[model samples]
Target: MKGIRAKLSTLLLTLLLLVPTMANAHTVSTTGPSPDLRSALGRLLGEHAILAVVAMQKGIDGAPDFRKAANALNQNTDDLTVAIASVYGKDGAAAFKTIWSSHIGYFVDYVKATAAKDEAGTKKAIADLEAYRMEQAKFFADANPYFDESIIASELKHHIDHLLSAFNNYANKNYTAAYKDAQTAYTHMFATGDALAAGIAKQFPSQYSDASSTNPASDLRSALEQKLGEHALLAVFAMQKGIDGKADFADIAASLNRNTDDITAAVASMYGKEAGEAFKTIWSSHIGYFVDYVKAMAAKDEAAAAKAVHQLEQYRMEQAKFFAGAIPSLSEQTLAEGLKMHIGHLLDAFNAYVAKDYAKAYADVRTAYSHMFPTGAALAAGIAAQFPEQFHTANTSSVPSVQKVWFQVKSNLLTIDGSKTTMDTMPFVNQGTTYIPLRYLAEGIGAKVVWDASDDSVWIIAGENKAEFWLGADFMEMNGQRIEIGDPIIMKDNRTQVPVRFIAALFGWDVRYNTTDWSITLTKAMAMEASSNHH
Candidate 1:
């Protein structure tokens, strides 16, 4: 329970850090880009590119991880929807999702057609995507009058071209061209985010302020976060390319090396030349350790992998000590713990990638990327403290409070515990009961689901209670006694589906069926009691 809470806290804190603080209208204006809005859009748009590449790659290969990749993409869409909602409200977000998701579906269709070698199907999918681009462009242009429809549509067409080129190149086995296109597509999304965010900021001047003029420190911190985080992302990508012996392996690795130099130079600017050199050596050594681990895994050398892990542990200690020595405010213990987490997330992401667990891999990628910002923030804060003259102004920005909302398919939106999430597979009514994805629902409620393939059974362990059920079975064993459900366990679209009401009842949650909105809300009994008490 402690571990779960800690994990949730970390997730929440990372999210809070990414949100830009609302600024007053009277604040001094800047002519250039808005740093706050850029930071927010960069994260989302960057992630969209990353996930899209992963999905396309996995889809073409017919890999099991494709489902996970798609799910991660859906989650990214949810985040984008929330970001849109923050500015334009719920209806606007819903409208955006409708168009955005259609494009994703079209991409999926394209991939499927490619896999089947159906040229006509592929052409149809491409045509659908072209139509989707126009719709999306119009959606944005209509929502925000700051941008011209013709210009937005032209840009959208370019974005579509980049993605389609990447996919087509991959389908043709043109690895070098494919990767180059992917990189271009990835980079282009940042520009998209920046432009869109600028439009929003201009439209809502009171709600959005440029961080450069008001809070240079936060702006600087965001810049550091972007560079350092991108280093981790590119390093991982380079390693994967290396492992696959891709034609562009050298180019990608060179990119990663350049990122290292960039970070080192950034450090040198803040610290001294000697300290920067020291930091460069230490930082690059960890990347070397990761390479060693990857090589060991490729060779199926467990002992070598273990040795690499041990070396990384030592590297963490040395890195922590270096930070502690440089910054008086950062304690060794705290730094060490944070470094361990950083190392763990990176290793986990790498391992998941190797194991073909695309979902976990991308999730870890997000976690690892997010973890770096705090490292940057801590180091920046220490520098600011040490050289108060250089950073005279204090950061007065406050974390934005988030409201959790709930979602329904093609209907009005709702909320759960003030949080909103999207599922690829929507809940549906089967006979008299509603069915939802078992793993998603269970995990959302902080439960673990273990599948026994030999027996086609699922064991859901939530807290102290255990529930067991076999696929196509009408009976579920909960804590010992067997209870009958109206619908049997079933599988749809490779996802396990179970009756929502039955699972909620067994899990001690109150289930409310919203007929008007066509949504189902599940609240834990304890949470409901707490809510009532507060009221």
Candidate 2:
């Protein structure tokens, strides 16, 4: 889920480059009890995505459990409808149900059409789905002032496209691609859920109290919770598929691996790449032990099964110790105790399935899935405590004073709001254009700076505005349009140097050059009048 978020963020950063003011209007809250509505919607919506995929696959295969899977998906929709009712009343719930169910029917129609090789029927189903997107978007837009009809429609389109991509690949027997897309579709729903919940909380603040959904700590918790819960569900599914020797077993395993990558990458982001790799080694080993247990049970090897259990016990300690060493708030004993319950749930669920107790197996699966939410919260709290600065929320509305920064050409001295500091690299001028250290200047103004190693791109996010610049690119992309810089970005003393004027322009910083002092002053006022005017 974290990986999917990263990919989605990259895509959004590109799209949002053109609409700076609207980008950060409604931030999604992912963690804490204050965002319970967000968590609930995320869980149900995510479940719906996975269950829809399962139902479609079962329908295509004529599996005996197709009806049951379809029922589960419908139940998720019903739950979602109830959630909407709490905010919009009975009539709104009915309207929501009608539109939502229509989209589901369209998906079912698409599956049936594809299975029957009815190309025209498939086309019509897709066309209907496209139309359904608008109706659904309009419903949400009318219900919430924070939601734009066009933006809602765009998000709905992506959701539809993901599900369709998954099912289409499944119909074509592209199992690997099918499962990958399915996992993506599943994780994408949490974002949608958070968006809806955030808007609802804003619309009725009295009902939600003063809890803000845009808090950084809450976002971290929610993200980890969603990913961990997803891991539990996928693990159960993979174990079932493996034990039954299903043809899609390998694909399910692949999906689980992808999930692992996301989890490890998240660890990397918080603990560095080396720690991430170490975490992956410990984490991947547990999955392998689970597989070994399944294989042993299939062969009725009692000794092997016992050995697998022993390996799992060892893994719990290692995993717990690793986290305890990294997070001061987490104790090895506590983490191990929690992990014991997790291992037990998966093993118990698998054992139930093997014994033909299908009801208990699924019931245990739900228990296992629900367990991860708190686990995620625990980890999020620890991480937030460990790195408070990283999770600090940017309060754009409470700028009580102007932020003024000054930089002198060929000098490493920097001044911010009357405080002086030294930068590693000094600002310089080339052909009469002054270039400032990207990181220092951006961070001085409460903007977020990110370096993407994947493409050697630099992204700066300030309030609702975002700009992307590549290492050697002579142009910067802002608000969806490219502005030529006349010269390529340069690296100085291991720091990224960019034209200060462009940064000032994008973020609404007032710039003044002093010919006598050989210094440039940038000021960002509380009202952001200059920025609004520039835009």
Candidate 3:
């Protein structure tokens, strides 16, 4: 175990450290009016917020990594300047750089004042920021018609407030509030990115060639980027909090759980409920494994650390497989490689922090954060390709939503939304309950049933809801709550049979039983139609 841990740690450190730093490492779309520009701006802007927050915290603590964090933030600023140049030209970039760079200095002034316990200096710094906000808002407003100076100024103020609150809370040892504010500050930039990009795209529709910045596909990309990038950043912070034995470790963990829930919801919205449940389990396990590694390191338990690494190795392949199945364009091998890099980034960063290499630790944090942009791009493209109508700019066609399912007791025939099929095992009456083949009924209602061979359990997912029960178990678990099922699942004709009414009710499907013929009918509006209607 010691040898394995050493080797794994060494590999991560080597890969992360040897990678060259690029100034503008976002997806560049040189061709006119591309949504890719929106993604790029979002990445750079969001990166700026996270880096700024981290640097401010480091500044307050006088941490060894303070200079490195500041430098990284500057580099992000440079990237943003270059991104502006691409759209508006060098003169405009220079104007943006001057206005943007001054605000950062004001933030630094506030940090220094707080560190010195100079109340007046802090007030003066705030006044300077208040003034800078107007100048910055005017710069954007003058450049684009869509930007209202007052609204932009207000947004900038919120950004400043969140960052200052985060730093002040950190300086006062209010770590939980500090981290929460930090996360908000980080997320706030993405909105700014969207607004800025949308305005720019509108300002120069010819350059973007009529591509809408807020198109469905582009929105999907930005969402995935935000969630995945935020995951990496939050994971790094949680690991830091854990290692330091900070009181806010639980808060950070809760934040990570919330992020996971969001990612799960995104997947469920696009793929289905089963995929979402599976993704949640898989994604959450990697986080748990990282926690295990952190705990093992604190305890100086090399074997435990190695075991955690082993679990993470398994997680990479499992996660890759899940993505490969969900997105046909993503190959298992390729996804595993990408996940390996992600895991490596977290592990390497954690190890660097433990060794007091704070600079490298923060650098790895930036690297890990930036790496998710292309990943989000890949996923967005794949999803759009898989469901063309969902991403179509013009809504001229639609999917035939499944809405009804029919089954009869002791009959192998099944009807799903007017389409008939034969089930391998027919539904039967046991005592007072009607039992049906679990998989057949689940699929018939547009829900999915997944079997876990390792535990002899079955999972049912309907829309955003998921339930799991082991074969012959008299209980089922849904969203972490256990419920009693009086009738246990059993095998009939070599098929898993579950109570019909219970399954239907769990999925919010209306159930009808004809006493004359003993036919069972399940009805529900499928997600596709619901989404179309809402849209």
Candidates in order have lDDT scores of 0.64, 0.73, 0.72
Candidates sorted by TM-score, best first: 2, 3, 1
TM-score for model 1?
Answer: 0.60
> Which residue pairs come into collision in candidate 2?
17-479, 17-480, 18-479, 18-480, 30-222, 31-218
Pairs with backbone N, CA or C atoms under 3 Å apart (clashes), candidate 1: 404-418, 404-419, 405-415, 405-419, 406-414, 406-415
Q: Flag the better candidate by TM-score, 1 or 2.
A: 2
Model 3: lDDT equals: 0.72
Compared with the true structure, what per-residue lDDT tens digits does model 2 show for residues 161-246? Answer: 77988988988889897886777677667767766776687678788764655355566676778778888888988898888888
Deviation from native of the Cα of residue 98 in model 2, angstroms: 3.5
RMSD of 2: 11.7
**Poorly placed runs, candidate 2 (over 4 Å):** 1-34, 209-211, 392-535
Ranking by lDDT: 2, 3, 1
Top-scoring candidate (TM-score): 2
Query: What are the C-alpha RMSDs, in order, of all predicted structures?
Result: 23.4, 11.7, 17.8
Model 3 residue 289 CA deviation (Å) reads 1.2
**TM-score of every candidate:** 0.60, 0.69, 0.66
lDDT of 3 at 267: 76
Each candidate's number of clashing pairs is 6, 6, 2
**Model 2 clash number:** 6
Residue range with the least summed lDDT across 10 consecutive positions in model 3: 1-10
